[model samples]
Target: MPTLRRTLGLLAIPALALATALPATATAATAAHADTASSRTVLPDAAAAGWLARQLVDGDHFESVFNGTAYPDQGLTIDAVLAFAASRSSDEAAAKATAWLAKPEILSGYLGDGTTEAYAGATAKLLLAVEVRGANPASFGGVDLPSRLRSLQTTEGRFSDRSQWGDYSNAFGQSLALIALHRTPGDAPTAAVDFLANSQCADGGFPLSFGQPTCAGDPDATALAVQALAATGRTAKANTGLDWLAAHQNADGGFAAAGATTSNANTTGLATQALLSGGRFGTGLKGWSRLVKFQQGCSADPAVRGAVAYDATGFNAASGTRATAQAVLGLAGTPLSTLSAAGARPDSPTLACPAPATR
Candidate 1:
């Protein structure tokens, strides 16, 4: 039998100030306003946005594919959450993030799926997430992490498996690892930085992997790398990536995943995050506004509400929490903010989160 997993909890505090500050009439009036006018061009204040960020921060836990069981490994999810949470100065969120990093599974690897070796990129992301949440440098697993990180490096200076490398050279893995290395307060080799600069495609975006036919940089992957580079004081390289992203904006004021056939909340959200990291907040704000419109409540559909859903040609009722989380993540630059605002929370203990077999 297939096992069930409960990844994260939904802890929402009511936005009493937001609700009370705006009377029912004003709220309804704003809802009735046109998308252009209703979508605030300015990024929401960090405090105003904290509630949503918390939702994103807490929703990172998902079931481990190994051992046919569920476990909370924030390593995979905390980078993005910490970015948003740190911006808001959320003390509670910081504490939770710190606790997750201190978990043994992060550095030593989780005890499932045959004790798979921890990936360099995953470990790097976890470390950055912890720091963003306000953990001390000592809170990291100490000198062991740097040694393990070095071990994952290829002779070419890129990280990840040589044969099946995916997105490492192109800013995804390198970016996260760079942030971890930068935060460790030790001398890092120049080769790693050199590898990132060399991986840039002629079009100015990073690919999902090195030497793949598709050199098109994905918005989400690019965003991850952009932030990583920025963290490591590589502002110029980060700017180039951001420039490429800005050039790729669609006519709809949003971003396409790669080739620009369609705009998606996932790609758009990442683009927004990247832009924010690069200090291009104005450009990111426009894209985010467009995304918020796309994620407007699912009143037109019954299976999902207040969440984004996708289908090639027909609606798929089976898509569940993962889709919701992705859409929420895509919309808010963090997960759970929009979901809470819409009053929908992930159902615990086997919340259905199925992605399409093929994207």
Candidate 2:
């Protein structure tokens, strides 16, 4: 297992400022109004814990599916999958990630052609793979991943556009690149941190694009940026983003995706992880507890429980195991207490694989 290291920095800002500046109303009213506290309540204890454990075990299978199918596309979906894989410490996931590290097709598709989405996702995945798998960052065909990463830089310290791909002003894209740079050695991490810090909106949230009309500080983008910042040793910046997340939690306790009405397990899981990464455990616990409640038992609602069917949107909801893995990683931040009592270890499961490949 990779040792988690902490870095100290000097960018303190009161959490109150964050709460005041990024008020819940700043999020879309339509999105906020749609959520109801009644629909989002705590689940029975057995059901919640079981859901979390099952998800952790199933995370292994999700990585397998992603490596086999989604990874070939080299998109944001793959990036998210890799982040989840690393968090769960999937066994064979490292092998598939190593394959991606070695594959020029995957690298060039994103970095060489200026595919912003792919570049962001692939960069994040590669960084996490190195950290979790202990893979040699430089061993893959002498590929200078850092240099390829630097190629994405724009004059503003953010990535610029290539081949008429429009302005590269996406927070999601920048966050992934920042995460990659943070994991790589040298000044790239510093530059990435500077870029992200300067990009923070007055609301303490981050906009998806620079100077774009839709650039309201959003929860999804903010969460990604917060995690990237935390990974890079900028805890204060990460905390500011987390404060925004805390305020965005619906009355029911789940997070909405950039002020969207629909609160799915996937975005909630990401936001929860980001909050925990920033050391905002109190808020993380609340959000996570709510998500656990949603997964109480097999149900028709994808939010309440894992889905029986497979769709791109609900891919993460395929099984109770998938949701459980994500929630456990997000909330517990370590192996389940129950697992330890049963003589099972963190990042390792003794359960037989579930059938039908839920989701």
Candidate 3:
């Protein structure tokens, strides 16, 4: 999947070695939110994560197909890493995916070689992923991911793409940049936080793109922005964004992208996590309830069971990967800023279906 970003915007770990490698802030943050998943059993979360793990090629990476050719999909792979960490299941898959991403060639392609302009969103996201897996971002793939991302920041404080392709970095990029940097040495800079906080639309939500003539709220952008703003201690801004999300929640408890009336698993997953981050547990659970309905449960074909579909229409291969990757975060009820794989299981666990009742 190219991600909703391509359509609209854009778009791992160990144990003792991990523990020693992780920053104190990351360790502490992980500890504080460790119980976030306790409010619900989430047997479905585990199964969904399990099914997601199986979709990775070679138990490590995912591929994006174009026409008849397949290319390594580093972006989607990172999404899987986050989902695995959030669910606290499929630890091995998350670690393996992390390692795969840390490869020199792969890392270079996604983040860009110095000859090519570095991507703010990709760098920030990868930094967060490596950190979440408890790996050192400074030394990952023999490059300093955090430092690299910092270098992309503008004088005005936005973490922008230094790209020949034009700066496609959006609110999602800014949010990831803030969140990833929050775990690093000095935390996100004041200017960067202010830049994002100030960009909020009048509707009490964030826009997908910056520098637009008129700001319009986008569900996916607003959700990710809320997490970053909350992590950075911009409580007022975060709460306002949450208010916009709450206002947009459909009667079915799911959320749709900006300007769309139909609810989708991707937006619901993100908005639910935002709600949880804002401490709106009841509202978050409502989003969760709607999100799970998009999942293919026991009634689905064996290959697709536990996979989340993009919409109520049900599961299809095209949208399955992205939907499942994003949805698991909400289903597991873990906010992205504090997500880690510290105590996750090494194996993917299948759904446990109960026996049919006898007449």
Candidate 4:
């Protein structure tokens, strides 16, 4: 029941945003108003979903199969799930790609190669995917997702992990952990919220690490945190961070990744959600339209019809997998939580939130 309720709640955010985003006028009026109107690009929802649909390998798996780079099927598959959900893709191809990710083998891979101990961040991501898709994370791939996500939170309020990635997944993991747990029945720990909120640098952007000494705001991390906070009803607290993001949009209709700050689709896609959350999509319309420009159309190749590019330079099979997945969500005007579904029975007598450490 908790999961079902969360699902219905999430399905409304983007619909509201998109309605607000459309121009009040018709074609000629919109054409004349382009100079000042705040609107979503002309990109069709089906085209974006179709591009992601083509990336699925075999009938069930998606891979960076084209980009020469081999990303773990686990991460790529999760992205596919979000892409389908945000676009509300109901075609046969969309169903197959989503179904493939539900397989036990694929879910286990998120924990890592089945032979090794699971990575907390990977597991959290899979749990999020399961929840968003209305799958039972407690029994997903033979493990309980909500329980494992809780165990990963440390006493200090960090979803700290020393997995092989060496804490690299900390910022992302913390944000995701909060979001995944938010879908269940309970207040996501106040400490966890503070942990993510305090991670913000003076610039109002969060770094990849919550406690880094010289951390700068990152488009990806900051944008992600924005979605988590917005979905969880902390939008006021997340405002400054959203403002920082709006301020940084490049003159081009896009945003840059951390460090490089060059306009790119991935960052733009992620940031677009934050902007929408802040009700500042008009301020960042250029950035949003910049992403529309990144989409590969049938003119290029009907086979890659809706593939989104990483940068204006053009699409690369390698980076496009993640970038396109992330981009589609932003383009669809949804957040990371839009994919969250019921992972466990929070109503169960035995289901309990982990107690936060006493300060």
State the lDDT of candidate 2 residue by residue for 94-186, as single tens digits: 344345545766567555543433254455445544544455665553555556557667666775445455454477767866765655556
In the range 104-202, model 3's lDDT, one tens digit per residue, is 899989999845678889998999999899998889989988889889889999988887888888899999999999999979999999999999999
- Candidate 3 regions exceeding 4 Å error are 1-42, 354-359
| Residue-level lDDT tens digits of model 4 in 1-359 | 23322332244235334445666664532332232112222233335665666666775566544457755476777777766666655345544655666676666656754333557678777777777777677877567778777776778777755466565557777788888888877646778887888788887888876666797888888888887777677776578888888888888758888878678888888787667645675754555567666766433444554677788677787788788788876666666665532232111011111244698
Tens digit per residue, CA lDDT, model 1, 1-359: 00100100000112223433555567542342222122232222222223333344353333334577656645434533443442233334444445555666644553111124446666555545554544554436443555556667777778663223233334566776776676666744568866776677777777767667756677766776666666666778778888988888777667777655676655765676567445575676566555444432312232332333332222233332233334434334432111111111222211122233685
* Best-to-worst ranking by TM-score: 3, 4, 2, 1
TM-score of 1: 0.62
TM-score of candidate 4 against the unseen true structure = 0.77
lDDT of 2: 0.50
Query: What is the alpha-carbon lDDT of model 3 when measured against the actual structure?
Result: 0.82
Q: Rank the candidates by lDDT, best first.
A: 3, 4, 2, 1
- Give candidate 4's root-mean-square deviation (CA, Å): 12.3
The RMSD (Cα, Å) of candidate 2 is: 11.5
Please give the distance, in angstroms, between residue 334's alpha carbon in candidate 2 and its true position after superposition: 7.8
Q: In candidate 2, what residue range of length 10 has the lowest lDDT sum? A: 4-13
